[model samples]
Target: MDYRFSEQGGVTHVTLTGQLNFAANEDFQAIVERIAKIRGGKVVFDLATLTHIDSVGLGLLYIAHEELAAVGSSLSLLHPRDTVLRMLQLTEASETFDIIS
Candidate 1:
């Protein structure tokens, strides 16, 4: 998957495109670091351009969630595609994250 990072009004945003799978782990981790550095430590993952996600991708998202939570921060998923949204719901991952429509 491809991701772009930006910050606005104290919140960090990671805009994801393409498919989130095993190959995205390293890049995603780095993006998390950038997000963590933002003053409020609040992150939003924009998934509107994302097309698909596998188990590994879900794991990475969970990792990000736990990391931010541990630091007293938060992570939210934004505008996930139908397929990705279904996967999160099917795996019960949706409940673990804050999903924004």
Candidate 2:
């Protein structure tokens, strides 16, 4: 997936726009490094355009969550599509992360 990062009022939001799967690990790491360097307390994922977020993607998100939390930061998902929602429900992944409606 592709992501664009922006900051405002001390919040750094990374908006993802595309499918998040195995092909996107490099992109994920890049985003993570940028956010961590800035020490943003709130790491928001704007999934309004995310067509699908796969298991690998979920794993990456979990890693990101833990990393952020270690530094007193947090992660949140926003505007997930129906398919992604269903997967999260079935896998109980929603309960594990900060899934915002």
Candidate 3:
């Protein structure tokens, strides 16, 4: 997976592309670290280009959520593709995250 980070209106936006899996672990960790620095900040993950996600990818999202929550930050997921959305739903992660269309 590949990602780009940007800031808009005081919110951090991350655009994810390609596939999300174990291969993305290292890169995702960097994102988590960046998020750890923010206090009471808002983050949005744009998953429109993310075509696929596996269990490991789901776990990474959870880790990010936990990390951000611990630091008084919030995470939101935006425009997840159908397949990715299905996985999130199957795992009940849809309920855990704030997903925006």
Candidate 2 local Cα displacement, residue 65, angstroms: 0.6
**What lDDT does each candidate get?**
0.87, 0.82, 0.93
Candidate 1 CA-lDDT value: 0.87
Candidates ranked by TM-score: 3, 1, 2
CA lDDT, candidate 1, residue 73: 82
Question: In model 2, how many backbone clashes occur?
Answer: 0
On a 0 to 1 TM-score scale, where does candidate 2 land against the true structure?
0.90
Question: Which digits, one per residue and each the tens of the lDDT, describe model 2 over residues 1-25?
Answer: 7788887787788889888888999
State the local distance difference test value for candidate 3.
Answer: 0.93
Taking all chains together, each candidate's TM-score versus the true structure is 0.91, 0.90, 0.96
Q: Please, what are the lDDT tens digits per residue for candidate 3 over residues 1-101? A: 89999999999999999998999999999988987798899999999999999999999999999999999999999999999999988998867899886
Candidate 2 — which pairs collide?
Answer: none
lDDT of 1 by residue, 1-101 (tens): 88888878887888999988989888888977766665447889999999999999999999988878877789999999999999988998767999987
Q: List residue ranges in candidate 2 displaced over 4 A.
A: none
Misplaced by over 4 Å in model 3 are none
What is the lDDT, from 0 to 100, of the residue 82 in candidate 1?
94
Per-residue error for 54 in candidate 2, Å, reads 1.3
lDDT of 3 at 95: 79
